[model samples]
Target: MPTLETLLLQLNSIKVIDDTIPYSQYIPLDLSISNLDLSQIDIKNPNDFEIYIETYLKKNNAKVAFGGYNEVRNLYKQSSLFGDGQVNERNIHIGMDLWIKAGTPVLAAIDGIVYGFDYNAGKGNYGPTIILKHNLENHFFYTLYGHLSIESIENIEIGSFFKKGQQLATLGDSTVNGGYSPHLHFQIIKNIEDHFSDYPGVCNQKDLKYYLKNCPDPDLLLKIK
Candidate 1:
């Protein structure tokens, strides 16, 4: 079987964020152990996190930031929804996050129909979410767009077709986007299975092996680097 990464490598281009944002202006962010910036924010305060994000973009003179597939993040530590009892806290993220200003236009990476959508309201949740079903090459897979505004999913249907680079949704603010900074959490899934509207974008270390395969490195297709 050709792995998700192998299939993604065959694609020439895929853009989840608006194509209008130039590649040169993209600042790749790191929230792992190597980053000094992640330490500046108080995980409990959304405004504090947002301020750091805004400052980082301004300092670098960049419009948007990208990266974070399989990247371990400390942002979810404050939420019990991620860490409770038997579940060993899911901190390892499995998506390519495109961090930019709120209300930024989000685009479809490829031509696909809306598979499902929902308002996952809660702290550390995806907020307004949408999943698109696509048949790329011979593989039937799905793409998830997270942290979108409520309006984004207001008029969407189960089978609404969207063209590549088409304006699909707009990013949401901290009030709706799980109390973090504004950004689009874009992820690719090999098998959506029984999940719809909401899926695990972050996983615990014990479950990393399954998620890493279930959700391949989106950068393989985004090729932002």
Candidate 2:
């Protein structure tokens, strides 16, 4: 059996985001405090986060701010969903986040059937989420799209089929998207383990090894570089 990394390298044409913006338009943005200067701004607030994203994008002359997988961040500290106040904090993001404007159309990366959809409303939640199931080279896997607008899941049905590049959902604003800046949390799951429209997009240090393996780098499939 080929590893997920192997499969990703084999399948070289997969693209999760729209190709209208050339790959040069995408820039890497580090949310972690170690690299970015966040001394004056509150990283937890969505407005401030948005400002930071916009400022950084403009400074770098890029349209999309990409990269977040395995990044340890402070944005999840405000919510108990990430084990806030706990000894082992779930601050390590296990998926890639595409920092773009709200209402941006999210497209399907491959032909798949909608496994499920859910509205997980709360602070530091996935917000409107969708799960799609696909089979490639006899390997069954799932893709998760998070931080989507409420309308994204409106009238969405399970088992719905979508072709590659099909419009799947739209990015949600901070108010509805877990109080964070608008972005798409894209993840690939090798084994869902009964999870429906939701899965852990972040993990604690204690569970890093497990999640790092289960939710491999989305860039492998996105090929955004």
Candidate 3:
């Protein structure tokens, strides 16, 4: 299994986001917009909003964007979004999102093998997701990359080897990704429990302690800030 330090070293080398530029340098608009606040821009439909976000990412020359804690909170409350009445207090977010235009490259954070993949189609869902299993030193864990294009899993074989920082997939748009702005939903798992291609990205406040322990802060590896 790998130690946290070893995983950090691998993720640091991956081009998950633009290191030369800060998110503020790329997205001048209030980060709040990425959340659930829809009043700032005129969005008659979901696709319209998705396109707007995708365009913004491209203009900023950002290969990937991060930061949206507040927005994700709002997404949970939206009935039209997750459709789960009243935020699943037990299902608050457990991952940090990396916003980038669809088709933007996604790389493995560590050397791992394909664990599973799935197409969870719906608003506030992880569409075309992939999970990789890694064993470092004596620690075994998993990494999940969600909201990916369908092409990402078209021919991927289970147990396939993936080198650290290898191009795993590309970001998917709202049409394919869950009905929201385009982004990569990355999460770390200590025990997958036979699950594949999908894991809880959110948890209720009551389970916060458990989820936090199971899913360590991804920034520990990504170090985006």
Scored by TM-score, the top model is 2
Predicted candidate 2 versus true structure: per-residue lDDT over 1-225, tens digit per residue: 987678877776665666577778899988774865876788878899899999999999998999888998887878988885477888999999999999888999788999988988899999999999989888888999999999999988889999988999999999898898999999999999989979999888899999988888888887887
Superior candidate under TM-score, 1 versus 3: 1
Residues forming the 10-long window of minimal summed lDDT in candidate 1:
32-41
lDDT (10s digit) by residue, model 1, range 92-209: 9999998888899998888899999999998999999999988876789999999999899999999999998898999999999888789999999988889988899999999999
TM-score of each: 0.94, 0.96, 0.78
**RMSD of candidate 1 to the true fold?**
1.6
Q: After aligning candidate 3 to the native by TM-score, how far in Å is the CA of 124 from where it should be?
A: 2.0
Write down the lDDT of every candidate, Cα atoms only.
0.87, 0.87, 0.71
TM-score of 3: 0.78
Judged by whole-model lDDT over C-alpha atoms, candidate 2 comes out at 0.87
Question: Which of candidates 1 and 2 is the stronger one according to TM-score?
Answer: 2
Order of all candidates by lDDT, from best down to worst? 2, 1, 3
In candidate 2, stretches whose alpha carbon ends up further than 4 angstroms from where it belongs are none
Model 2 vs. true fold: TM: 0.96
lDDT of 2 at 73: 85
